[model samples]
Target: MSRISNGQLVIAFLACRLSSEMITIPGEMVSYGFDRFAVILFAKLIAALLYLPVIFITLKFKGDSVITAAFRRNRAFGITAGIIMSVLLSATAVQTVLSVQRYVTDTLLNNIVTISGIAVITASAVYGAVKGLSAVTRSSVFAAAVFGLLIFLIGVTMWDKVEPDYLYFSFINDRSHFLKTLISEISMNSEILIFAVITDELRSKPYKTVIYYLPILLILMEFLNMLYNLILGPYMTKVEYPLYIIASLSDIVLFQRLDGIDAIVWLMCGIIKAALLIYCIGRIYTVCSNKPHTTLAVAVSGFLIFMLCVILGSDAGVYERMTKIMNSGIHILLGGVVVPLVVLIAGRTKQRGRVKKNDENI
Candidate 1:
């Protein structure tokens, strides 16, 4: 497959991150309100620092995922890397499915038999995964356009509702609260793992993925936070889905309200994210198994995610699984930071040994 364009990679990942944020509306982020501005700023900085290992590893092993590169050097190391990423990414896919289920149930379907919703989402995800990353990223352009129009509509109709008075300023007084919120914000960024694993090889200017992504995400999130604080003000706390409420406020024609369109756009983004995850899983499978059985891999990955969603159901069970994963921060740190760090260190140590041998021979 041809390399994924950097623009496509950036937009696709951005949509996934933004969609996840909109659906999640992290309690810490909502709770902190205006004060979250500082937390977000600091969190992005911390995230940038954490991303260095993966970024530099790409420079060393260009055109390969860390696992692929490691596997080339040491089969055992690559297998270990593959296993860790496979587990984490599979969990990530499940989390995406569960989130999509919750979003569609609470907003779009608002009915029973939520399993049907999971079926549709996972099924579409499989199709996208089968199409491969290039096709998936291309579809992201369409999803992004839909999201952009939604934002425009929201801005046009809801601007007057955004009372400057709704905004307020106060630092979080509790040190523990601030730290916890910071960690939560940091952990929510599973997109980094996607970039680390895939985009490094795809983007010609690999680091720009982070450069183009973080600020855009931070700005978009801050804008949404501002909307929550500005439009809903104190009343925002009462609603489970503030984005739904924001959409409901817009008086669009045909649909008569934007909430339905809001759901569709979010659903599209969710499917796109799930597809990306499944595709990555397939790629990892190819690396581990040493066969280009991408089609089989995608099928199996989709099946696995579908089974997980079915088994988990669509209630407190899914919620608890996702919550534990997010709260722990281990998945993000290990996959996004530690694994790449290992690759970087191993690569450098090997390079130095080569240099020593060359000098000694002289």
Candidate 2:
């Protein structure tokens, strides 16, 4: 396998990690009011800054996968952290697959398909995971390009619907509600830490260079949040698939309808995201297990994920309930425990030099 650059890692992280799920930001902000978008943005910025020190410490430890680093420092603590993260990643894959299925059913399919969409999504994810990191990263680049084009096309078509005044109004009636909603938005994007665990061989770049990229990411997120609010407003809460709403609103001279195309784009993104999660879990299993055949571990992990999707049921109601449960649970585990524990253990072990070497073999 060839080395992956930090730049490529960053791009792959952004592509697979970021999604149109920000479409939900407007609805999430409804109780907080429009100004809450700014507040949420600021909170995310602070969260990112807080995360930077941990990332720096992880790098200092020679880029150990968070689990391995924790394990090296304390076996018992490491195993607990690993179990929590593995379950969280698995739950996220199921939730994301179900969400995509729900979006397709409500916007494009009209409930015509009888077979399970979860199965199809799981199969695609397994295929990607089997191909390994190179395949996953390449697919991310291609998917990101396709999504970018779709976003540009939709923007051009909906240029006339833009309203500057949408920024002036507040969405929340009370200050406490606004703060709570802002925290929720931060929690939603906390998945970034999952990527941090796998990223061991980043391109050599100055700290300042990496820090400079944050503004660009935050600006794009803010713009997308504002765009959805301006176009959908209160009506946005009623629609489960706000990106599809944006797609439906587009009408160019040659291509009058693009909701089908949008659905295809979403399906591809969903597959990439699911595959990455599986890959993360597979990596964790490989590190923790003493098994001779790592491929068997991967297969077993895939099978468990498949069962999870099936048990959850591939419907809108099931999807919503499962999301509420998984999101809340995972956020607490990640923010409340895993990150802090990893940092604390790594500090005590002084195992920074051995982490990179151990990670390379695993």
Top lDDT model: 1
Candidate 1 is scored at a TM of: 0.94
Model 1 stretches astray by more than 4 angstroms: 25-28, 200-203, 314-318, 356-362
TM-scores for every candidate against the unseen true structure: 0.94, 0.83
Runs in model 2 lying further than 4 Å from the true structure:
20-25, 74-77, 112-115, 201-213, 290-293, 314-319, 327-343, 346-362
27-138: candidate 2 lDDT, tens digit per residue: 6555533665676577657656655644665566666656666666677766776687787777777766666666666666776452466677777888887777677778
**Candidates' C-alpha lDDT:** 0.80, 0.64
- RMSD vs true structure, all candidates: 1.9, 5.4
TM-score of 2: 0.83
Question: How much lDDT does candidate 2 score?
Answer: 0.64
